[model samples]
Target chain A: MRWIWFDRFVEFESGKRAVAVKNVTLAEDHLHDHFPGYPIMPHSLMIEGMAQTAGILVGEARGFSEKVILAKVKRAEFFTLVRPGDTIRYQATVDGEVTASGASTTGRIFVGEEPVGEVDLVFSHIDKNMSGLEFPEENFVFTGEFQALLKTYRQQGGAKVAL
Target chain B: MPMSKDEIFDKVRATLVDALSVDDDDVRADATVMGDLGAESIDFLDIVFRLEKTFGIKIPQEELMPRDILQNPDYVVDKKLNAAGLAALKKAMPHADLTNFEKSPEIDRLAEVFTVGAIVKFIEAKLASK
Candidate 1:
């Protein structure tokens, strides 16, 4: 739900280096009561941010198929704290290819460079209906204007991003 | 997509013994993954990862946690569905309106397929367009 558009995307990328930013605003409901006068991003939310960042990587590695689910968190270390108004950077690498099931994919994640937190995740591309299976969709809500924003940003040469 | 119960169980057993180091005996139908075996949240998650890799499937957030197949004996659990699987769910189900299943009797009887591998094939078959 915290995932933003335009700004939280490939603001800059070149196969290896990519920079995505999430502007922490007081408008966030969590910031309202996190500490009255002080608003610090929760550690877990930081990981979610990392997950979103990593999610984009997976989307790029493969096509942006809705099937890919961030499956596992191999490792994550939090060394600092993320507060409102700060933009966290999620950097990753294509360590190698993973051949599981009957498909081959590149596994990757964000290693927190500045030190707040980093996540080692594995994403799997899957089918929506396997059996009588239904998953919780409450946590994930796509911002309605995401695609439009992406298109608009493309027009602006990826320079202006409103917080 | 409809794999037999024996085949599903065999795959589940392999994931347990091979990936998680759990004994084959511990992976039975009524095995009680988190309830009886003391498998922590992380352990269950790791098992889910093993399932995905082993079966080429993904478990979405909504269905992954509740389907307690290792504990429940009645339901034959399958892999966690992805977008395609979800589409298949919406397509194949004549009563596609799932607005009521949340409160139906199947809620309790529903056996969660904890591992991604165990449920994918089963789900594919189950959700295939009939």
Candidate 2:
């Protein structure tokens, strides 16, 4: 999957929680089609941003051995709309141990301390061979770019994992 | 010179409520941390951290959860907790109330025994030993 939602990790504490930022800009392709004129950020994309933040946190806690996927969103509520030039910050906290099969987390979105959204997300893990087809490691989306981005974020004083 | 059971329970209850973000009334003696009180695995670590800070005690991870012992093939037969494993757990965690746990325990449900009272007892025993 493309790591499109979050831009960088602001704070990460492994096995506990994480904070990431997503910058919304008018130059993005999604903003044009989401609305012909108004151009408000899509809530679904916001949720995906939160999920990606939580997913990385969960994966790091498990030493990146398991393939984590979003299973369900138990709860999601948005109090405000996001627009271009507004940076959305997501804070995700793991609710439990990230087992090989499943895990759960809670995420909240903010714009400079103003709470805009909150979500309770459940995730499922599948083995690399679960689909009976083996793809080379290089074919995966979490490759050089992702690692470089994570490294940059880590230099910002974020923990190695999620929190 | 350890805390009274009531005192221990009060502290444990507070810790659970704070860590799990559950209501104070929900953290009862018989309330299971995962089921009734809505605590997940990550919350256990938070709870342990809080307990360590509150009581000034250090609880090793292996002793606190014993994941290795629980998952060992020799200690688990056909996904059920073997007698030897159960006995070892009983000895290791004398503070927890496992009286209601099944004789042939399901591996996943083992964490259910970590109720609010169980944590209180664990802290009580740890403080007394120190």
Candidate 3:
């Protein structure tokens, strides 16, 4: 199973905000073993979904030049449990200027039109923040798989989606 | 109207509480950000972001923590800051009180300089300059 969380970007505004959706289904092996009889979408994965949604937004804001890594989960609070057949909508907005060192993002998670949770995250441009550390030359964070998702979004009429 | 030191301290305390998930009482002025409040390396970034938002200020990476000095061969010698390094650090962070740090300039103890009070002073200076 691939590590990609959300299905696709539904709405994207460069340097500002992006929205993505994910459909929960029992076909996912983790849901089956999570409770056996009572299957609810794991909160941890939901946070991951939010991270992917916000993380991509942050990475794209900088033209994917920096290896944007999720540095911290500032806040994650869920109001309700998500179940199979529910479509999770992740709306992420950049909280402030995307500095060379790092950026902070505020996110809202919704199942259909009703709000289910919120996940606020912080991402570091590792090259700028990790002063003494060294990472690979290539952009490992935004691999082909992640970029393909953005390409798919652009092909699906997200004309404003920048490369 | 300019905010008083108490007001700035209150706001900084709140920011530290949110960023570090520590109790309100734990955010005393003398508390070291990493040692007493338990802030990891990444948490410093988070705190900087929060401080920027809370105070409506732009905090450059070097201004808050001059990691470059630690890595500079001329500034650091045998894991300790030389006289030149101490002067450079002082120039970099006028907001921080380096009296105690000056006595023994070990690189390891650099984190001790960033106490909650130091942050309040930093913000006070930034706001005053504006």
Collision pairs in model 2: A12-A163, A13-A162, A13-A163, A17-A162, A17-A163, A96-B41, A96-B42
Top candidate by TM-score: 3
Question: Per-residue lDDT for A107 in model 3?
Answer: 94
Which of 1 and 3 is ahead in TM-score?
A: 3
Encode model 2's per-residue lDDT on A1-163: one tens digit a residue. 3547987777878878899898899999889998999899999999999998898888888766566767667578999999999999999998645554446788999988899999878765544213334655552435567677666655764553332
Task: Give one digit per residue, the lDDT tens place, for model 3 in B1-130.
Answer: 9999999999999999999989999999899999999999999889989989988999998888888899999999998999999999999999888999899999999899999999999999999987
lDDT score for residue B70 of model 2: 73
Model 1 segments beyond 4 Å from truth? A1-6, A10-18, A27-29, A98-113, A128-145, A157-163, B1-130
What's the lDDT for residue A143 in model 1?
Answer: 34
Instruction: In model 1, state the lDDT of residue B99.
Output: 40
Per-residue alpha-carbon lDDT of candidate 1 for residues A52-80, written as tens digits (9 for 90 to 100)? 55555555443343444556565667776
Provide the TM-score of chain A alone for each candidate, in the order shown: 0.65, 0.81, 0.91
Ranking by lDDT: 3, 2, 1
lDDT of 3: 0.90
Label model 3 with its docking quality class. high
User: Ranking under TM-score, best-scoring first?
Assistant: 3, 2, 1
| Reference A-B contact fraction recovered by candidate 1 | 0.07
